[model samples]
Structures are given as C-alpha cells and as structure tokens.
Target chain A: MNAGQQTTRRLVSRTGPSICRSCLDTLSRQPYSTAAAAAIQTEPQEALPITPPTPSPSYALHAGILVSRPPLLTRPPHPFESAYHLYQKRLNERLALPFTRYFYIKKNTPGDLEWKRKIKQRLTPARDIGRYRGYGDEAWNDEVLVGAQESEMAWQVERLLEDAERDGGEEEGKKGEGVQTVGGPKKLEREPVERPMPRVTEADEKGDVRSLGRLLQRSLYLVVKNKEGEWVFPQDRLIGKESLHNAAERVLVQSGGYNMNTWVVGNVPVGHYQHDFVPEHLAKSANPTELGLKTFFMKVRIMAGQADLKSNKLGLTDFKWLAKEEVQKTVDEKYWRSIKNMLAER
Target chain B: MALRELPSRAASAVLHNSRPAVLALRPSGRRNASSEALRDVESSSSFEVPFVSDSLVKAFDPIERSKRRRLGKKPLPPSRYQFRPPKYYRGPLHPHQPPPSSDPVSREFIPGPFASPRLEQTYQSTIASDLMTLTYHHLPPGYRAPVQLQRLREWTGDSPYFKGRPLRPPRGGGGLRLLDPPRNFKNIPEITKVVVHSMVPEAQDNSAHLHVAGMIVQAITNVRAVTHKARHNVVGWGLREGKYVSVTADVEREDTFHFLSKLIDVVLPRIKEWKGVAGTTGDSSGNITFGLTPDVVAMFPEIEVNYDSYPPKMIPGCHITIQTTATNDRDARFLLQSVGLPFYGKLVD
Candidate 1:
C-alpha cells in the first residue's frame, strides 16, 4: 500500500473502527427499509407525456391559478436519432427564458391529475427536510423532498388536504382541551430561543426562487454580517446551497429587519484598519459632527475584475461598518459571557 | 470649445512650467467676442494683449480632432490648438474654411447660444481668456482634484454639526490679582492659555526628529510668555535663564491637544498678571498666547519639560512640524497651514 494508505490504516487501527456510530446503528437496524424507500419513490422515473394535458374548463379560466403546468419537454430517441438529438438541443435552447419566443402547454389529463392529488395528500405539517435535502439541491427535488415534489395540480389538492388536516387536528385538540403545536413541541425559555432551521419552499425546486435569490444577493445585499460576525452575503444565505436552505425564512425575519448594508466609496473599504486619530483629523478638517458620528465615506475601485467573483475575489474598495447598536451589543455583558470562557483560553 | 480655450491656463502653466511665485504676479484675463460671426474682433500684434482668435480657439477641442480627421485634411494653424509654441501669427481666420463648431464649451463660453447675433454683442466687451482662467481655478476645493475626485461622493449632503460652546476661559486670571491673588495664590490656577507653534527645518533635508526637537524648544519658550502673564505679570521672568531642555520623544503629531493641555496647567501659574483669558482680546501681536504650568505636564508622563528646571534655556525653541513626501508643494503647504499654522503672514484673522 502507499505510505498515505498505510498511515491512514494505522490511524484507523489505533482509533478502532472507522464506521460512524449513527451509520452503524442504521446498518444494524435494517438495510432493506432504506432500499425499499428508495424504490417506492416512483415519480422521477415516470416519463412526461408527449403533450401535457390541457387544463379543465374550470381551471382554464381560473383567475386564481397559482400554479400552471409547462409544456412537456421530450428528449426521445428516433430512427434519425442524431437529428432528434440536434432537435432536442434546439428545443433545450428554446427552453431558456432569455431567448425563448413562445411557450405553450397542454394541460389537465385525468391520470396526471390523479398523480398530483396523491402527491398533494402526502404533504403535512411542513416538516423541515432541509438537512436531508443536500446542499445546492432544490428544496423540492422530485426524488429528494416529497413536500416540494408535488405537481401544480397536486399542489392545489395538497393545500386543500392540509387545511382539512389542520381543521381536523384543531377539532381533535379541542376534544383534548385545546393545545396542538405544529412541529411537535416547544420549551419555555426566558430570552427568545432562535432555532436556525433551513426552510424549503415548493417554488425553490424547478422554479425561479433560487436563481432570483442569487441575482439579488450579488447585486444589492452583497455585504452582510452573519452570526459569526463575518461580512459576507452568499446566495446561500438567501436561498441556501446545501440541504440547509431557506436562511431568509429563519434568520432574516427573526432578526427584525435590522440587517446592515454596505456600499463602496473612495479607496477605503469598510473595516479597513484605521487609527483613532483619523476621526480626530476628520473632526478638525471636515465636518466634526460627521467624524464624531462615524459618517465619513470613501469611494474606491475594485482591484479584482468581477469575473473572479466565483473564486472569492475582493474588490480594491471594501465597505466596513461601525454600526452603533451592533457594536454595543457585541461588547454587552450577555454577549461577552456567551464567548468569554472559550475566547479567554485563546 | 475653441482651441485656445480648450487647454486650461493650469495646463498652459504646467506646459510652461512657470514657478508659482512668478505666476502669482501676472494678470491673465479671458478672451472675448463670439466666434460665430467670424467677422468681429481685430487681431493686432501692436498690443500683446493675446486675445485668442475665434478661429484659433475653435481648434483646441479633443472632440473637434475627430471631425477634422473626417474632413481628410488637418486643420491649419495647429500651433494654438497643440501644446507647442506658435511659429507665426496668422490672420483672424485660418486660411482653410473652418468647420461648424460642435464643441460644448464654445456655446457655454459665449453669453448666448450658437447662431445668435446677441452672443457676440453680449460678450464683446469682456475678453474670453480671462473667463477660462476663472473657470479653471474656481473648481470647488477639498476632495475634488483630478486625482482625488474619483473617490469623492457626488455630494456630501449637508454641513457637519459644530459644537459652538464658548471655549473654556483661560485657566489663570490676568494682571496682578491672577499672579498674586488677594489671598496669595490660594487656588493653584489652572494653566489654560496655550500657544502652540510649529518649527520647520531650515533646509528641507533636515531629519524630522531633529526638526521636532527644535519646535519643542520654540513652543516652550513662547509658552513661557503666557505663563509669566498668568501669575504676577513678570515681563519675561517665568523662565529663569540658562536652563536648556529637549524632548527625547518627538510629539509633532500630538502638539495641538498636548500643547493646549500643557498651557492649561504648566505655564499659567508662572505668569505674574495672571488673569484668565476669557475677556482678553488681542495681544500686542494680535495673536493669542496660552500658558500652562509645568505641573500639568508632570501629570502626563509623555511630556519632557521639567517644572523644576527653573531657569529656561537659551536653546532655540520648537513649533509643530509637518513632514511630507508628495510632489505637490501646494498640498504640503496647505496640509500644514490647515493645522492652525500661520502661513504667508496670515494670522487666524
């Protein structure tokens, strides 16, 4: 074996078995159930129809149509398979929103409608499936998340089913003296306990939310402070990349919209190291009140081209904030106690 | 814009590389008479008044160069348009038929818009050359220079708030009562009036350290006057002669606040006629002097002056010092002068 392999083996041998405790527990319980579960997910394997069913007369004119079925996209092989591939390629190109000139769909067939109704019936309680979904995967990937995998027809049916279930649950709870929490239970705590959970939306998978979130994060709210105090606004922070998606649903709303934003000016970026004397000098030279209130601004050019943005490229100019409330909160007693013991060792 | 008007006087001055002191003495006005007529204004060599010709002024624009290129021939009399010196003076209009003016400044420089007869009539009395010079230098100062402009915001919005509370009264009272109080200096008077001055190296090459040392000597000596005035009005006796002193550390950077504090404490009590400086207006030189006793400097370990060093030294004292490595002497001069320094015999007045 290679030296690296030998070293890894030796380490494993010294540490005992390499199997994860949880994985081992899963394996010991039964491997068959997981396989059966995987096999039971039949929605993805079913090929789309040559033409999607047209909407029923009622749906066709429905002004409240929250969901609409797109036309069936086919990639079928043919006698002239190569030509068919080329045609498929052209059709795929037409699928692009920017270049597509027209789009039409045949809606509403009975069999498809039944499948939608069945999928809709399965959704309940809106449980967080983010951890199981995997990063960058849409919240509603067909094989990944059942709650998000339902078709448009199924979605409407699902909403009706959920309303019925909620009403039924409330009635049952009323019989049992009036208390039924949505996601199981909650514990009483003094300070509001904020649980960071990823929220998956049906629109995120095979829909526009993820892409739209990316555009907004890059263009507008590029610089932001996270829980770790790092100034970064990844699209992942908006739509989420990993299975832990829907940061906006959790932290953003919980934080009461007090999020700070930044803009670049001059050569000085925000958070660039500055001495106390800068304020004194500005107070003497520029407007003293601005200096005292920390309102001096600078404009600077980005040193790196925008192309390297995917590689964590930083511009020459940076925007730093000395946000008053945030800084005060940072030095507060409770916040200090939270990190003090461990930081003291460092 | 006309060729003659296209290049700013600053650019011409830069091209000519005239010394600032020399240029300060000259009076260069603008040109006059709109170029639309191509018929008005006389070109006379008799008086070297140097009013730019309407034709010569038309050629200097960068945008016009593209138009001249499209015409398949270079414009004649390129000297006025280019940065080079003119070999000869031509007539009022160039030999070639001048193209129509599409320049932005051409219309703006004149009183009225293009093709208007009133344009020439309105501006005929004033020379155009003077107006160009006026516009060039009249750019708003502070973060608006070509180099710094890119970084400035479109607008700073509003003026910063200033706290205009009356400055604290000078610590010691003036005249006899301040120096020898009715109860004989009962309350140790606070040294309030501090006079801060800066010292520069006689030569540009002098070490910043040595220069600051010299400045400290001067500031201390000058401060002595304020101190003497505070206590007993002893003319110049606050410092007993022959005690030479120097600061080991260079504090040229902190002189303003540091000296101000020192004046409030150390130098005030030693003055004989120690009345506070609140009601006092102009000193003999019309410049205010502040004094602090050495005791205050004793409170701060940063200062090196000794209160017990009774007799002040004969060594030349120091003032605040500024060090710069930039090419712009004007920027360097402005930088120091902005920090409350007296420049070109201009006082705070």
Candidate 2:
C-alpha cells in the first residue's frame, strides 16, 4: 500500500475503528473556515520600540502642524512615458473611424467655413485631435512637435512687416485696419482664443519663497523661524488636558494666525519628533523635572490664504513655502531626516 | 443616426479623397490664389478645401431627410440601427473582424469619466503621501526578510520514503493567505472597487422586492444591478434552488470615489448613534466588508429624494465591500481611514 493510504489507515486506527475515515476528515476540517482568520497581524502601534520608557524623567509634549499645500499641478510625464502615450494616441487615431464634423458644425455656417479653411491649409485628417502636431517627439517641455502653429507665427510676422511698410512709407498704423491685405477675406465670427498663462510665475522669477504661487507643480510646505532662531514648522507647548489634534490646531493658529482656512487630516498624529532641551534652556524653566520636548505632528492641508506671522505667539521671525528638496536645504539635517518621509515628492 | 448621415457623408468623403487628383489636373490654376491668400489670412485653396462647394453643403440636410424618413409608413430595416461587437476574438489571422473597444464605432465603448471626483483629487493630492510615510519601515540595504516556515509541512516520521515524498498541504486545508509585503513608495494602497450586494429573501415570493433593491443599489452606485439566483435550496432561510433572491452592483472608477465620498460626507453622518465601521470587517486581504441597515441605506440622496416611489417596506439593506490594492487589511484600513472612514472596535489586522 502507498504511504498516503497507510497514513489514512493508521489515522483511522488511532481515532478508533468505529469512526469512518471520511467523517474524521470532515471533523478535522470543520473549523477551517476562511483562512483569512489564520493570517498573523504584527503591528502593535502602542508598543512601538522607537522610545524606551524612562521611569524618572518627565517629558514636555509639543504639537507641531505640518501645514502643506498639495501639488498645484500634475507632475510632468517622463520622456519614455510621453513617447509611449503619443504612440498609442497616434495608433488609436489611425485605426479609428473619422470624427463626424457635421454633428458639431452646421452646414454653411461660419464655423463650418472656418473648419474648411483650416483643413485646406494643411492635410489634417478628421481623427487628428487636440494639439497633435504629428508625433515627431513627445517631450513634456511642449516639445511634442516643432510646431503646428509655425504658419501662425509666420502670419503675425508678415502682418508686422506689412504694418511697418505701410506706416514707415506713408501712413501711421491703425488699430481698426480691418482685413485688407493681399487676397481680401472677410473677418470670421469666432473669438481669438487666449493663450494659457506661463508656468514660470513672477514669484519663481524673483525666487520668492513666501509666495504660494511659486513651484506650481511641487508640494509646498510652511516652515516658520522659531523663537530659537531656527526654521521649523510652527509648534507650541501643549495646553493642559488638550488632545493632540486640538493642540495642533491651537498651536497652528497661535503661531501662524487665523488668516488661512485649514483642515486637519485626522485625530491621530501622522508622525512625532523628539529632541532633548539644552542644559541652559531647561535650567531657565520653572519646572525642574522636564527633560526634553516631544513634538507630535498633525498633517493640516491649506485650502486657501497664506500664513500670517505678524500676530505670532511662538515669536517666529520669518515664514516660507518651500518644496520638498528646498525644505531639505532650508531645515537642519537632523530635522530634515526626521520629517523628510512625510513630504510628498512631486 | 450614423446611417441617416451616411449618404451625405459618404459622398463628401469621396470628394475629399479625389480632391488632390482634381487639383493635379490644374496645378497652375490652384497655385496663384494660394500665394495671394497667404500674406494676411490662412491661404484659401478652393481645389484643396474639403467643403469647397456650397451646392454640396446645401445638399447635406440630414434634419429634413430624417423627418421625411420618420414620416414614411414603413420603418427602416432592423439591421440598419443595431451594432453588436463580435462575440469572440477570432485571432489576428481571421479576416472578418471587429474594431477594438477603444474605437468610437466599437459597441463596447462607454465614454467618460466626464469629471474627476473631489475625493479622488483629495486622495491623490494629500492622503496618498500620508499613507506612504506612515507605513514605511526602513530596512538597511542588503537586509533580507526573515525566513518563513514552508507552507507545505514535511512528513514527521522521517521514514526513508518521506525524504522526497510530496509534502502535505498546509494545516487547515488551505494555502497561506494574505501576503504582507513590506511598505514602500511603490505599493501605497489605493481603492480599486466597491461592491454593493443585497440579499432579499422576500423576493422569492414577490419580484417587486428584487426590483426595489435593484433600483436603490443602481441609484446609489450609478451602475446597473445584476440579479442573482440561489444555486441551492436552504430550508431555514426559505431559499429554494434557482430562486432569484439577490441583486448586486459593482461601483468602479469614478463611481467608487463618488459613492465613498457621499457615504462619508453625507449619508453616514445622518445616521444617529453610528459608532463607525467595525475594525473586524476586512477579510485579511485588502477587501473590507461592512453592512448598511435599511434606514441607513435610505439615507442616501437617491432614495431620500424620491422616497414616495419606493415601497416603504421593501428597501433592502446591503453589504458594501471596498477592494483596495494593498495586499493586507492593515494597509487597506490605513488608506480608508485617511480617506475619512472611521473604524471602531478592536482592529483585526
């Protein structure tokens, strides 16, 4: 007999001759419900080995607000990603049925005439959509194509030269000089579309860290100069019996003032930082038992308005909205190491 | 509609294709007008333009023709309006083919998402980073995970045959469940889908129960409910075999975000004495299941807006299972918690 059969026979014999093998099997399997219950759970949040409890020393609890403006714009695509996406777009366009132009543009309308004039200027297929300038390079720097609007630039330059020739020779340039050059064409009814604002704002040009407008694509965090003459997120000593989240909100309003609207993410702190007080600083305090400060950071998202530091409770000298890498350079190394993981990379 | 537009569109398409050849016949005639037109405005080339003739444009009156066709006694052929995607992918070698689903003409194409949900934006913007940071455990470079016991146990007797014999299945007659992978930037949990399922035993006698359940589910989820039949008879539950007793809907993509946000922001708060979801709801894997009572379900805008229409007695309660990308319940719970879901009781993970 096979070893498998032998084990089954021996198991049946061990159980007793009265019990059927199948019944024994089922009885053994009875408690085997969803195996999800069998899986072990390891996280013991309260039992974190990060800090060992000290029997003697009393610690000062501080609440810090990690006030941040989430990314204002999407991160630019990688070179390879843009290329792949462009290839897929082009392939889809090539295979797809032509867009029904008549559905959108009524027959013999100005819009229809304008569309006709556009396609006649170039051999553009109905399927070519958006600013699809024919797949030369899918660069995120808007280098996707050299330009479909090269002819657009040429006309502007042509008009400028025409204006110069007209004014320089005999007449002054008129603002309302209606369509009167070369083969005369009537003005179309469509409004000239406005160009999008440039990505590089004035704040970026002047290298202003205080402006929320700077670094439009990255996560900008608020860091204030503390009473210690060091840059940190605005923090304050916890009030008696105040919860961590309440303390966080209080400290944030006390330090930054109530100019901005903010929402705290949750009741539980996202992270905590602990550091020892200098001997001189502790000696100056009334309480003799206090050893060091433990700051629990609560994440607060800034929906609107800027941090106002004039009504400061913590005596902050300055404030700046800095991106992740900029925060690293501005804040001390130890502080950076402690808080870097919490910042979103954009 | 595509069929009605076909005759005019097909004729124009023919004109567009044959234009270059027409222009090639009179190259000199087309060249001079183009140069004159270019100095100020976009150069209008009559021969090159797709819609050059006003007569052609005047002839393309779909509204008038459609009216005439509708006025006719006999309707158009049944085959003209219907378009069905091929039942099977017959392979690349097959000649007769269906267009890819992404194609506009493809039958399977349902266009959207028309807009990004507010909760989806919030999660992508703020909550995602918090989850990643909170879960991250720093291990030194080149450090390996501790070895785990093999799932299949070796035979205990150490009989010579046991050495190479096929090891037995793990205890409890199941494979090791729910992988607990180390947290990193790459594996941050994001919700995949929310499934709303309602079981209506009353539906066995009256199909109206099933219909009402379906309407409520579809309204809240924005997806059609699929009816399910009981495969086996259960005497105590009064469920007979092949009985239609349940309706379910899978809320996915933008619908999932909208449903979750509506639950968190509106319906859930309205329920009095709500202690929040039980922490033991998750099934070890990243799926968390929780039930809403009939009154709580009715709290949704879909039902509350039209409460009179639904028979007051037959509103079915449903279990919502949120499926996330996380491998374990711990990460899934963290993600849901960050997205404004509250959990009470001892967390199983």
Q: Which stretches of candidate 2 lie over 4 Å from their true place?
A: A1-66, A69-220, A226-315, A321-346, B1-84, B88-100, B140-142, B154-168
- Report the C-alpha lDDT of model 1 over B128-191, residue by residue, as the tens digit: 2112212222111121222212321233235443244333443465521111111111221111
Give lDDT tens digits, candidate 2, residues A199-260.
67999999999999998878899998888889998888888878877998898788778998
For every model shown, what is its TM-score relative to the native structure?
A: 0.15, 0.50
The per-model DockQ list reads 0.01, 0.04
What residue runs in model 1 are displaced by over 4 Å at the alpha carbon?
A1-222, A225-346, B1-306, B309-317, B329-349
Q: Taking the tens digit of each residue's C-alpha lDDT, what string does model 2 give over B50-129?
A: 53466655575554556677895686565655666677779988875888877756765544453356688768877777
* Top candidate by DockQ: 2
lDDT of 2 at B105: 61
Instruction: Give the Å error, residue A264, model 1.
Output: 6.8
For all the candidates, what are their Cα RMSDs to the real structure? 44.6, 22.9
TM-score of 2: 0.50
